[model samples]
Each structure stands twice: as structure tokens, then as C-alpha cells.
Target chain A: MDFRINDEQRQMRETAQEFFEDREVLERARERIDGEDVVDDLWDDLSEMDYPALTVPLEHGGLGDDVLYLSLLLEEAGRVALPAPLPETLAFGAFVLDELGSDAQKEQFLPAIADGDQRLSFALYESGQESLPRDIQLAATPTDDGYRLDGTKTLVPFGEQVDTIVVAARTGSGTGMDGVSLFLVDAERVDSEPQDTLDRTRPAAKLHFDDFEIGENALLGTEGEAGPTLQKAMDRYTVATCAMTVGAASRAVEMSSDYGSQREQFDKPIGQFQAVKHRIADMWMATQAARSLTYYAAWALENDEPDAARAVSEAKLFCSEQLTQVFADDIHNHGGMGFTSEHDGHIYFKQAKAWETFLGTPTEHLDRIADSHEL
Target chain B: MDFEYTEDQERFRQELREWLRENLPDGWQAGERPGTDDPEENVEFLLDWQRTLNDGGWAGLHWPEEYGGADASLLEQVIYNQETARVDAPARINAVGIDFVGPTLMELGTDEQKERFLPKIISGEELWCQGYSEPDAGSDLASLSLSAERNGDEFLLNGQKVWTSYAHVADWCFLLTRTDDSGPKHHGITVFLVDMDQEGIQTEPIHQITDETDFNEVFFDDAVAREEHIVGEIDEGWEVAMTLSAFEHSMSDVFSIEQRWRSLVEFCQEHERDGTPLAEHTHVRRELARLHTRIQAGKLTHYRNVSKQMETGVPGPEGSMDKVFNNQTEKKLENFARRLLGANNALWTDGPDDGQWVTDLLMPYGKMIAGGTKDVQRNIIAERVLGLPKDD
Candidate 1:
């Protein structure tokens, strides 16, 4: 069994690397963190590169069902800490639409998403609740002509800027993975309040759906049957986050390695010391493990392997835990400069922490894995 | 990227599995094979098992066909390792011979040496052990003081080698000898293929923490290593030794780790505390799940190593990463098994699972020391992979 990426995937990854590198995305990310509106153009540039369409099906005016390919692009985006909702747009938005969207819904959204004419965001988690089907408290009451959504979706990626928000709300009377439904809502009709997220590069918002009425055509999939579909979508999003964590952790290792080689205290590079050297080595090992698990999870999900859910949870758990440690080690290696907001090291550190808490924390994923295995 | 084996590889795995199923001695069981308690019987049984594997064309599966192997691809070798572990097949007795010495010979041995040694090594006819570490040169192997002075047609070997595994039963040794002191510590050393069944060589078994005698302290006095037995040049043994060590580090142990993890899971599933299975406890489930994820990640890391080796045609520093990861993960897993077993972890022969968890827990310490210490592996990754400045 070959583990190396194929030539096409290699080419796509290389192209993404060149694009992200040439765009000076990291510098722009720092600027955005400093309150400059420098990310919109970069997002548009990514759209021009057709990254949002990378995971859509061929029949939907996009590449095809390739989560692995989309993950590669997300990894590149994560490497530079690109300030955008690329994961939300592609891994969650386009992916869910392709998987469970009706023909009318696909026709209305997929092509525009592929054409980079429309941006999408997902609203899954609610305040003080986990991202589980039964945990969703958002109510989608049946109306005469449609349903009215009347709850808040916290931590919605790109919640304020995206054109459409896919919301997971309770539609039936059942609980615990039953009665959950997906709806496509116009972003303008919802009240969005951007939160002061730790990862400014990928901002989040709290979307308030106060009796937000939508027509029956707005239903993403069959009502009360969206549990598995939403779970799969969340799994895709989790794997995307993992891939990004690999990239960001890798970049952190590189940055720390460079800093260790150049920064000296005892008339030599500090890296010559076993303390620093071994720490970096461990960080490197952790990053490599994260990459391997992320890629395997992505492949498992794409192929619909029997263990896909468990693999996804495993990847999320390992990557989230390891990325945080890698970044902490990195920051420790950089000394004082690593702690400053001005230095690029803190960017990765913050992003690692943010990603660790995103989708699911390490403990949450561990529970998911345990439950999946019926332990 | 693909994780699925091709049909041919699957067939290779199935063939080996079928061979093992039909060939293993009657009443064979994992961890309770022919000789579980007696070292001598265990060695004999392992030798017989290796011969059986050789007869089945599975020994040294990755070796070239010219050398009596199947000429299996790297993936096939991985499959061999995994399937063997899955069935809990007896480990090959001549590991040093097949995994290290033969490969090193293929790379650096003369045609005569290959013709003479390769077949016996693969067949387990002449068991081999590596003689590299010395009393004072464990991590700093290049500083070993094992001297081998050249004479008329042979080298007179006089040195003490420590931590030599299976030396008591080995018929031959691939020795690292310091032939000169004129240059740096890493220079003027030589590798010699020395016969161990001679008066000049003696082995004293070292009882380990596991209460096993798998390790030994070997002393040599005027041991005869002919000039033709030298691998590569006389003073260039460092490169040859590094090659063997790379092979050692690159050997996949993830299958065994996975095996132990499965055993632990079974233990948790069957045993209970206060009317509930251990697996039902949230703490136990979390820990098992965590270890399970780490094991899967370790397996993937090994695949990445295999892929890298396939591309480069040689094991690189990435192998050290696998070694370090597996060593740590395996140690943690075994320790967790003990913790899960509680006081029952102390019982041997009569305890739960016949005290396998206890032995498994004590086993990883040697692994952490063998091939290379985990710290030395980190140093390799730091220096070779990360290009960090070496400590003065």
C-alpha cells in the first residue's frame, strides 16, 4: 500500500504552497489581527484559485468528491494562518450540499459556490452545548408555508460575512440524533455578533435566529433525517481542522528550528543544547504523527470506510492534543519573542489553541471515540 | 494516497497466514507457545520456527531472491510483520542475522561472504548476534575499545562487549573492533564477522529486570576474525555499523504494539470491578481510547517511514522518529495495561491472562535500550532530520 500522495495531489499541494507563500498570507494575517481589513482580498484571491470548489462534485460544477484534495489546500491555508473560513466554506458548506442537498438546493448553491460567486458558513454548535445532534437546542418549528428558526448558533465560522448559513436545528419530536434538520438561511436575515475569538485569523460569530422564517424550499435534506448527514459533515470539518493543525504545527516547528539555529546565548546557537534540541525533535515527531493521522482520517472519510467515524475522532483527538503541545514547545523555544503579539510564533500558538477548542476538544473527541467503540 | 494493500499483497499475506496456520506446532497459542518459561527451550523453539518459516519461503521475505528470499516488496514485508503479529506467530530467532547482518552483507559483503553466510542466516542454521556496544560505550558507540589487531591472515580480537542479545546461543557475531587510535574516535574501527563457537570467545548471561537472560556480556581473547571477514574497508566500519543500526531502527514493531493493545482491550472487556466491566468505566475507556488512537497514529507513522524508504531505497532519519514514537507509545501502553490490571498486574503465572501484562510491562525497557536509546534517537532526529547543531 502506497502512502505517498499521487502526482496530481502533489501538484495541487505544490501549487497551493506557492500561492500561499507568494501571497504573504502570514503578514496579512498579522495585519488583520492588528485590526486591518486585509483578509477580504486574500479570500477573493482564494476564490479566484477555485479553492472553495475543490470538494464539490464534478456534476456540481466543481472538481469531485476529494476530501483529501480539499484538505491539502486547507493545510496550506493553515500553514500561513490565513484569515478566512475556507474550512467552513469547503469542508462543511460545499461538502454538506454535495452530500445531502436536494437537486434544487444543489442547483441554487453548489454552482455559485464552485464559481466563487457565493460564500457559505455553517452554524452547528449552540451556546453551552456540544456539537451533537441531541445537543442541538435550536428549534425549527413547522410553519404554514415553511419553518421558523428560533435559536442561536454560537461559534459560526465567518458568520457575519458569508452569504448563506447552513443551520442544524431540531424539527421533530425525537431526541438524541433524531429530529435534527438542516436549513439554508439568508445571512442577511439573521443577527450576527462577531465574538472576540482567540484565533482572529478565522473569526467566529454568534448567529441569532429569532423566528427567522424560510420557505419549504430552504430545507437542505429530508427533514428529521439529517442526523447522519450532519454528523458526517461535522466529521469532515473535524478532519479539515486536523489537516490545518498539522500544517500550523509544522510551520511552528520550522519557525522554532530557525530561531534556535540563529538565536544564541552562550556563544553558540541554543539548539546545540540537548534541552532545546530534544524539545524540537519531540515537536517534530508530534507534527509528523498529526500529519499521518490527518491524512489517513481524510482518506477513510472519503472512501466511506467502516471505521471512518472512529478514524475521524482519533485524528481530531491526536491532532488537537499534539498541536497544542507542539506550539507550546515552540513558544518556549523562542523565549521572550514567542510570547509577544508582534512575533509570528504567537500567531501559531493562538491558532493551535483555537483549533484545539474548535469542532471538538481533545477530551470530547476521546469520549466520542470511546462511545463509537462501545467502550 | 492509499492505505489498502493491493490484491497481490493481500494474497501474499493470506499465503503466509495459511502457511502459519498449517505449519505452527500443534496446540500452539500466542504467548504460550512451545517454550514460555524455559530460555533454552524457547530458543530452540524459536530456531525451529524460523527454520519452518524459511522452509515456507517467508524468512527474510524482503531479501533478494538470489539470497533465498521471496524478494518481497517493502509493503509485503510490512504485511508479513502485521499478519505475523495478528496471529501471534513466534518471532524469528535469528533477528540479528536476518534483519541486520544479512542486509549489511548484501550492501558491503564480498561475493564469497554473501555466498557463504546469506543462506545460513536466512535459514537460521547459524544464529547471529551483533557485537557493537561495549562496557563503556553504550550510547557513544564509536568510542568502543574492542581492539582487533591484524596478524598474518587473521585479526586477534581482544575486547568486552556488553548488552549483546542472544550471544549465548549465537553461532556468529558481526563485531565492531577498534583497529587503530591514530585518528578520531569514529575512525580506524573495523567490522569483523567472528565465529562465536571458539575458545577465545565466552559469554556471561546478564539477568535483566524482566528476569530474563536474553542479554549477555561477551568477552573475547585472541578471537580469530580472518581478513576476508571484514566488511567494507578496515577503518570505515562506522558507515557499515550505521547501516545495520538503521535497519534495526527501521524494523516495524507497531504490529506487536497493536497486538498488546488488543489484548488489553480484551482484558478490559472480560474483567470487571464492582459488577461493571473495566471498559465501562469512563476513565478506563478514555485511557484505552487515547492509547488506541496513539497506536493507530504510530502505525501510520511507520507507513510513512516505509514510503520514505521505498522512495530513497534506504532507511533515513525518519526511521528514528518511528523508533522513538513506538518506544514511548509501547511503554505507555504496557504501563497502562498494568494500571488497568491493578494488583493483579503483580501476579505471574497464576494471575489474570497468565501474568502476560506483567511481562509485557517489563519488556519495553529493553526495547528502549536496544537498537538505540530513545534519547539517542532524539539526538539523531535533532541532528540529522532537523539539521540542528551538534553539541560540542
Candidate 2:
């Protein structure tokens, strides 16, 4: 009944953790950078292992699992500090295709992702990173036999390499979240390339759609009805993202506790000190509370919970804000050695920096919650 | 992680609702309780009804067994209140005794005090008022100049407590006084339970905005309180006050509020001006819808509290959070009701049965101001919940 990973997902997580353990996970993460997006061999290894197929429907070359399965996969990604977009591209990419894409699009696109034949990334954020689908500004106007889209999309995750780009755009003049539609234009059709984002390991781009042409088949879901669909997709994505951040924070707290226990100051391990112990205790409680909310969010999304958006936003914002301090303090608690290149602390520290703003930052997520509650 | 209530708990919820319907007195159930300004309003009858509840084993749900309480489960307590208030049963007669003094006594009072005071509270034989503030010590409560000095086997108490709600009628007062002159302001205090009918106890009633003289300034001159009457360790009254204040802040009366909302809703739809039902307006509908949502959020906040208490066993910082949500929501509901009721609000703005829309709105200001201020709750969060650096 709790919002937690089930037995199968737990087992799957351990397996993935083992995979990263063998690959010298830290080494691979450190080797990667912004432009290069160091997910080279990892993506193949994942596809060969059929990890990408877990959340994809069986008809689309996957194990026919639910959002719960994707949560576990994201947790695995967090634990290993793997510099990859499997959690975003595979989990999110597959979900959009299943929910909003037509039968043809699912058949034509999902199997390639499931079979490791192609990589896909979603580009939902318009310029200024509008967190809510209703506020999207990218406009797609009707044309002869197709549509002509002219808009700029920022914060498009992994925009460079992915072959599929799921885009949300305005189809009508209705303001503030209505009259919107979702389309899956070919990534090659996008006129812009990936922009160098703050977190080099995870590339996001500003997509400039100048006279971008799409056939009638490219329209995803119903016209002027993409807001709800995009919301549905965002719920799954936000929950899964929160799942990753929770794992990363849990790891940070654990690593800090371990280091504090073993590293001594003045004649004993620093962990025994009241100041250090109390902080660790507080962090443990925060981690547990954040985990509870995040897992609940996953359950709500997977179970078609009616309040999914509210729960998802609450969870995402909580974890996003909590993880930043949990790890930042981990560095503080380590004193000096924690900052050295040899230390594993940087992995979480870097992940926190990237995640703090991912999927529209903590403040934006909080506004969604405030709005939902009519605050 | 699980938010589902157990089947037994759910069943108790239903039974409680039914029992509240059948057992409660008619006027008390409407809890549109008459104002004290009108003695004919029969508020005394509501007090008697409270005793009926105590007799029915429904009172003191949160108290320990030793205190004549059933020591009910937290969920059961919530359900009992939710049911009682849903039906608009009159509020308990002595809020100070039940919510404030009773809990503080259970926590820090001596065994003899528990035996002497507990049964009387349950039987409604004794009502309690707080004497925490003097004229000058209003918000800076610890600066209270009330003195309690050792005089043989008893202490001679002399203080003037202002804004003592219902002091004119209370049987006893939970009084805070300065017991020492040598130490820190917080260190030299003691809490005592003093009989209101003592030799030198006198009260002067003060009329408030609602034209009720239920509140007064109580003066104590050489009042004698036995050593056994002191609650908690001597010279450590601040600690007891802080703990009691925490409960005073976060503990929400969700069960009671549900009924208030219902009554407010009923009042709006039942009365009208011109030819239209007052509830027909779009603005009213939207406001009610928003109020319902806030109530839902408040309910969820309380549920989270239950889950937390289940996890932590004792309420911690979240107590402040509950306080913040309930007080804020109550104020909003009051304002919402006032706007919906319109000019009808002005008609009863002075009567005993005056439409509570305006009263409810004014009451919110008091709710947030009393127990603890809004800023204090935020400070608790910023310090205790957020782990921020305290202001030096």
C-alpha cells in the first residue's frame, strides 16, 4: 500500500547496481562531459540487456512493465552515478509514444527504442522553460496537407542524439494552457542543434523550429487537447525524475554517514560528535519523508491516481530541494578529503546541481502544487 | 506510505456519526450556540450536554486512562470530533480546561492533582480559565509580575490576570506566577491550579466586539494554593508552558470544523433575499468550491500528521504545520462565508443568534493571535523544521 518499489523492481535495481559496479561507475561518470553526453557504451549495454524495453509495452519490444518499473530503473541510474539519459529518454520517450502517439507512431517509433535501434528524447519545454503544458508558446499552424511550426523550444533534454522529438505546441489562439497540441516531429527536421546546458553530462538544447514541416500523420493525439495528455506524460516523467533524485540523496546521506563514522577528528570518529550525529539524523528523516512522498507519487501515476499532478509536483519539489542540501552538507561534513578528486562525493554533488533545475526547477514545481491547491 | 484507513476505523467513523445524530440535544447539535450576552440563550444547557458526552464515554478521548479518559486511538479521536462537529453539536464548555489545562496537567501534574482534578473535569464539575498574562505581560507572558511566595505549607499568590476568558464563571484558574527573584526571567516561575472562589479572588468582566462579557480581568490578592496544587517541577514553568503551547498550536479540531462548514453551507442555501436562493451566484459557488478544497488540503495535512505520529509516536515540528494550516483555512472560510451571506451578515452582527459569518471572520483573527501568533509558527518552521540559523 506504501509508495515504494515492489519486489520485482527491487530485484531489477540490484541487478542494475551490479552492472554499474562492474563498469567502475565513478570512472565512466567522470570521463563524460556536456557536449559529448558520455552515455556512449552505457546506452548499448542497457539495450543489450533489454533494460530500455522494460517500460515499453510488449507489443512495442518491451517487458510490458509500468511506471513502478521505470522508478526502479531510475533509482539504479542514481546509485551508479551513470552519466546517461536512459531514465529520461527510455522511460519518458516510451511513455509519450504509448500515451499520446497514434497506433502508427507507437508501432513505427517505440519498437526501435525497445530494440535499441534508435534513441528518443522529449522536447516539451518552450523558451523560458514553461513547466506546465498549458503555458507552452511553440505554435504549430495548419498548412496544406500538413502543418508549419515556428517557435523556439528550450530545455529539450538530450536534443542532440535522440532520433525522435516529442513536441508540445500551440494549435490555436486560446491563451494559458488551452488550444495546445502535441506532435512528434522527426529530430532531424528540427532546425537547431543541442545547446550546451549547465550540466554537461546531461545535454539539453534550445530547439529552433523555423518553418518546420510535418505531415498530418505527425500530429499527436487530438488537436487542441494536448494539455491533458502532456500533463499525463509529465506526471510519469516527474515521478520518475523524483525517484532518481531520491536515490541520489539517499546515497549522499549514506556516504556522509559512512565517512563521518570512519573519519576521526580529535581522537574519535566525527560521527560520534553531537553536531554531526544530529545532522545525520535530520538528513535520515528528511530522506525517509521525501522517499515516502516520491514513492506515493509513483504509485499515483502508475495506478491512475486522480490527484496525480498534485502528488507528483509535491514529491518532485520536495526531493529537488531536499537533495541539494543533503549532498551539499555531505561535502561540508567531509571537511577536506571529501572535496579531493579521489573522493566519490563529486558524483552526487554534480547530480544535485543538474537535478536542482531539471524538469523546470523546484520553484516551478512548487507553483504547480500551490496552484492546484488554489493557494 | 499507505493512506488507507483500516476497516475497523472506518466502521467506528460511521457509528460515531450515527451516535452523534441520536445522542446530541437539538439546540446543541445546531451549535449555533447562543451568545453569553443573552442568559436566556441557555448556554448552561450546552454545558450540561457536554457532561452528557463525558458520561457517554466520548469525552477526553486524548487523555490517559489514569485521567478518567479512554486513551482512545488518534484516529478514533479524529472520527469522534469529526462526527460531533459535523452535526453542529455545541462546542465543549471550557476550552481552556479541555484543550489547554487538561493536557498540561496530564503531562506534568502530580498523582494527587490528577486524582483531584481529572474526575471533576470529566464530570464538568469544574471549568478552567488561563491566568498566564498580566496587563503588562500580555504577549511577553514570562514577564508576568504575578508573585507566588513561599508562606509555610502554601504559597501566597498575588496577580492581576487580564483577558481571562470566562474567569467570571470558571471554577479554577491555571495560573502562572513569578516564584523567585534571583534567576533568569524564565527560570523563576511556577504554575499553580488555584480555586476561583478563594478568599481574595475577584473578576471584572470586559465586553468584546461580539458584545459578550465572557472574558474578564481576574485579580488575586493573597490567594493560597497548596503545595500539591503546583503542576510540574517548581521554577521550571517555562518548559511546561512551551510544551502546552505546542499542543495549543498544532492540534486541530477537524471534526468540529467539518460541522461548522456544513452549518455555514446550510445557512447560505436556507435563507434568501428577493426571489433567489443566495447560493445561486457563481462567485459563491467558486468560493465554496475553493473553501472545500482548502478543507480537503487541511484534512490531508491532518492525515499526514496521523501518519507522522504513527511513525514518531509523539508530535514534533509538524504540530506547528497543522496549526498553520487550520488557522489559515479557518480564517479564509470565515471571510468566504461573510462575502456569501452579504447584508444578512449585518442583521445578526449584534444578536445572540446573529449570523456567525461575521463572527466566524472575527474569530479567526483571535484564533491566529492566541495560543501562538502566525509569525511564531513560521519561526518554528524556519528554525526547527528548516534548520536555519537563528536570529541572534
Clashing pairs in 2: A34-A200, A134-A177, B81-B255, B82-B255
* Residue B22 in candidate 1, Cα distance off native in Å: 1.0
Fill in the DockQ of model 2: 0.11
For candidate 1, give the lDDT of residue A225: 81
Query: What 10-residue stretch in candidate 1 chain B is worst by lDDT?
Result: B243-252
CAPRI accuracy category, model 1: high
Question: DockQ, in order, for the candidates?
Answer: 0.84, 0.11
Give the TM-score of chain A, superposed on the true chain A, for all candidates in the order listed. Answer: 0.96, 0.92
lDDT of 1 by residue, A89-189 (tens): 88888878887888889998999888887788988888745757668868999999999999888888778878899999998775678889899989888
Which ranges in model 1 have alpha carbons more than 4 Å from their true place? B245-250
Evaluate all candidate structures by whole-model CA lDDT and list the values in order. Answer: 0.86, 0.71
At residue A211, what lDDT does model 2 achieve? 88
Q: Residue-wise lDDT of candidate 1 within B1-392, one digit each (tens)? A: 88888898889888888888899888775445667778999999999989988998888787889899888888878888898888778777898898889989998999999999999999999999999899899899899999999899888999899999999999999999999988999999899999999999999999988678999999999888999999999999998997775552246788999988888788899989989999998899999899989989999989988887888777888888888898889998988877886786667777765655567777788788787898899999988888888888
Question: Which of the numbered candidates is closest to the native, going by highest DockQ?
Answer: 1
Q: After superposition, how far is residue B167 of candidate 2 from its true place, in Å?
A: 1.9
